[model samples]
Target: MAKQALGMIETVGLTSLVEAADAAIKAADVTMTGWDKIGSGLVCGFFVGDVAAVKAGIEAAAEAASQVGEVNSTLVIPRPHEELGQMGPWIS
Candidate 1:
């Protein structure tokens, strides 16, 4: 199997994260790893798939989340190092 890429979208609210997750899932063949709440209403959604698919998913997620609330940032890491998985369940 191809090494999975990781995609993340951070937003200011749960609603925005929900929107982001929806768009990400619908836009590409990605699996949602999970989500995290950073307190102060900040939330983040994570997805994993092929590099191209992850990049596409992140783009769609950011756009969709921004429409509903504040999107802080988005990231796509192609073939992230295995050690990253130790950081949290969301990274895998």
Candidate 2:
């Protein structure tokens, strides 16, 4: 099974945050599953080959964002099919 990872990052700016997240994702050599913005902050979404990559991605993302200012991040190990199961549940 493919290990899944999710991250929630609180940052100051959107553009820079996304850029940082992107760079971090690349550095970690992982695929970016998705991403979005919430208020003035950003919520980065990503998936990797293993738990280590996910953890590393989060750290790298934080480091990139920190270049500008404070950046807080949270990561989670998602259950397989949970994401898909939850999809569209609240859309309508």
Highest lDDT against the true fold, candidate? 1
**TM-scores for every candidate against the unseen true structure:** 0.95, 0.65
Residue-by-residue lDDT tens digits, candidate 1, 1-92: 23889988889999999999999999999999899998899998889999999999999999999899999999999999998898898787
Q: Model 1: C-alpha RMSD to truth?
A: 1.3
Alpha-carbon RMSD of each model: 1.3, 4.2
lDDT for model 2, on a 0 to 1 scale?
A: 0.58
Task: Please give the distance, in angstroms, between residue 4's alpha carbon in candidate 2 and its true position after superposition.
Answer: 2.7
Candidate 2 lDDT, 45-72, residue by residue in tens: 4444456676777778778778776665
The clash count of every prediction, one per candidate, is 0, 0
